[model samples]
Each structure stands twice: as structure tokens, then as C-alpha cells.
Target chain A: DAGVTQSPTHLIKTRGQQVTLRCSPKSGHDTVSWYQQALGQGPQFIFQYYEEEERQRGNFPDRFSGHQFPNYSSELNVNALLLGDSALYLCASSQTGTGLYNEQFFGPGTRLTVL
Target chain B: DQQVKQNSPSLSVQEGRISILNCDYTNSMFDYFLWYKKYPAEGPTFLISISSIKDKNEDGRFTVFLNKSAKHLSLHIVPSQPGDSAVYFCAASGAWGTDSWGKLQFGAGTQVVVTP
Candidate 1:
């Protein structure tokens, strides 16, 4: 079975522009979460989506938002991106109460580069 | 602020030796811990984990030891092989039933290099 998948392996945009990244969770999974990994740093939590509603969010600004579709796919949208927004966007999925300690499977991630 | 931290940015070890990576967290509410290994151009891969109740958890050559009182955990890879060369990340989550439990706080990661 295919694992979590993300679209647009890489993206480059200018400041004040908007960008949309897509993610498809692993089969049989329902929850989707997003993370941002900056250079030389670990992945930081962005937010999570469950039951088609946002379940939790991190310290990120309002410019970051996400949506979970009925099919368990997700999209992360960053409005008026800044150069600091350049980072690797990772998508993770977990089936509540199905895996070990809610182990999450992750996609390769979309590399976002803001110019 | 980063709740989880790996003080060591990188480590080098000889093959067939023991490798230990340390992680510390500032949040006491975290009960579940996990270690993930990542290679170039890939997402973090689950390695092993330990719950708060258990002080130790092992899988093959990989083992994790948790010290709740000290708020520290370490991942040990015995007889490390060349394939173990990669970046290892330590992550923690809040207790179940908490709103932030679904999101994991991760450390900056420790890069391990096994030299033959």
C-alpha cells in the first residue's frame, strides 16, 4: 500500500505571494498534521486536522492555515509568504487509536522557497 | 521556544561500537516519547519509543531509556553499523486526552556517522 504522499516536490515564490501545498495521508488513516522544518532545525508542529476540522495548532502566525478533506487528504496554505516561510513542509498522518502510541507516518515533504 | 532539545548536533562513531544520543525536554506533561531517523531527501522514519511508565524499551540493537524525574531520554544503538549513519530526532507528545497530544514536539536532531 502507498504511504503518505505530498504534491509539488519543490516550490519557489516571491514575497507577498501565496502558496498552496497538498498532502494525501496514508491509506486507512484519517488524521493529518503539518510541520515546518527550517535549515539545521527539527520539524516544528504547524497544526493538525481531524474530522474535517482543525484539532490543534502551534505557535505559527495566522498566515498559516490548513484543511482536511473528507478523503483524508490535506492542504496547507500560507498567505503573503515571507522569506522566513522558506522551509520543508512535511505532512504526517495517523489513525487515532490504531497505531502504536498514535505513531504518525510522514511524507517526503514539499520544499518551499520564498524569494 | 523549543520544548525538546538535542544538545549534540552531530556524533561520529566507529562501526560495531555503541552510539548514544541524548534528548531533554522541558515539558512535564509529555508522557509519550519517540525517536525517528531520517536520511537525505526523506521524511523522518519511526525508530522506537517509550511511554512514561516504562523506563526502558528495546528493539534489536536500538534501545531507549527514559528518566522521567530528570526529564531526559537517550537512544542507544549497539554495535552500530554503517547503515545507522543518519540524523536521529527525539520527539515527545503530551498526555492523552490533551488538546496538544496529537502534535509532537521535536528536537533539532543529532546526526550520527558510523565509520568503518
Candidate 2:
């Protein structure tokens, strides 16, 4: 079965611009979460979506938002992008919302470059 | 503040030797910990995990040890191979209840190189 898939392997956006990155969860998975990984650093959780609603969010500002469709696919939107927004955006899927024992399957990730 | 810290930015080990990666967290409420391995241009893959109730969990050649009192966890890889060289990250989360649903706090990551 196919694992998680993300669209537009890479993206380039200018300051004050907005961009949307897409993700298709792994087969048989329902929950989707987004993370940002800067060069040489570990990923930082952005937010998580379940049942089409954001269940939990990290310390990110309001400029970051996301949505989960009925099919369990997800989209991460970042508005007013700044140079610091340039990073690898990763999408992970889990079988359940419990988040404790559930192991997350990650996509290759979309590299976002804010110019 | 960085709740999770991996002080060693990188490490090198000879092939067939033992490789131990360490991680420390300041959050006492973190009840679940995980270790992930990542290659360049790829998202991290889950390696192993241990719950707070348990001190150690092992799977094949990979093992995870948790010290709740010291707020530290470690990943041990035996007989390290060149293929095992990659960046390792330590992640932790609060209880798995409804409110905290899998929110993970990650460390800076430690790069491991297995020299043949």
C-alpha cells in the first residue's frame, strides 16, 4: 500500500505571499499532522487535524493553518510568508487519534522556500 | 525554550561497534518518548518508542531506554553498520488523552556516522 504522499515536492514563494501544501495520508489512516524542519534541525509540530477540525496546535503563530478533508487528506496553509518560513514541511499520518502508542508514517515532505 | 535536548550534535562509530545516542527532556509531564531516524531529503522514520510505565523497550537490534526520574531517554544500536548512519531525533509527548492528542516535542537531532 502507498504511504503518505505530499504534493509539489518543492515550492518557492515571495514575502507577503501565501502558499498551500497538500498531503494524502497513508492507507487506512485517519489523523494528519504537519511539522516544519529547518536545515540541520529536527521537525517541530505545527498542528494536527482530525474529523476536519484542528485538535491541537503547537506554539506557531496564527499565520499557520491547516484543514483535513473527509478523505483524510490535509492541506497546510501559511500566510504572509517570511524568510524564516523557508523549511521542509512534513506530513505524518497515524492510524488513530490517541497519539500515545500510534506510530506516525511520514511523507517525503514539501520543501518551502520563502524568497 | 527547547524542552527536549540532544547535546551531542554528531557522533562517529566504527562498524560492528555499539552506538548509543542520548536525549534529555525537561518536561516532567511527558509520558511517551520516541526515537526517529532520518536521511537527507526524507522525513523521519520511527525507530522505537518507550512509554513512561516501562524502563526499556527493544525491537530487534534497536532498543530504547527511558529514565523517568532523570528525564532522559536513549537509543542503542548494536553492530552499527554504514547503512545505519543518519540523523536521529528524540521526541516526547504528554499523556495520550483527548486534550494532548499526539503533540510531539522534538530535539535538535544527533547525526550518527558509522565508519566502515
Local distance difference test values of all predictions, in order:
0.94, 0.91
Name the fnat for model 2.
0.77
lDDT of 2 by residue, A47-94 (tens): 988899998899899999999999999999999999999999999999
Clash list (residue pairs), candidate 2: none
**lDDT, residue B16, model 1:** 99
In candidate 1, position A75 carries an lDDT of 98
Tens digits of per-residue lDDT for model 1, B36-116: 999988999999989999999999999999999999999999999999999999999987787659889999999999999
What lDDT, from 0 to 1, does candidate 2 have? 0.91
Number of clashing pairs per prediction, in order: 0, 0
| Interface root-mean-square deviation, each candidate | 1.5, 1.4
Task: State which candidate has the highest lDDT.
Answer: 1
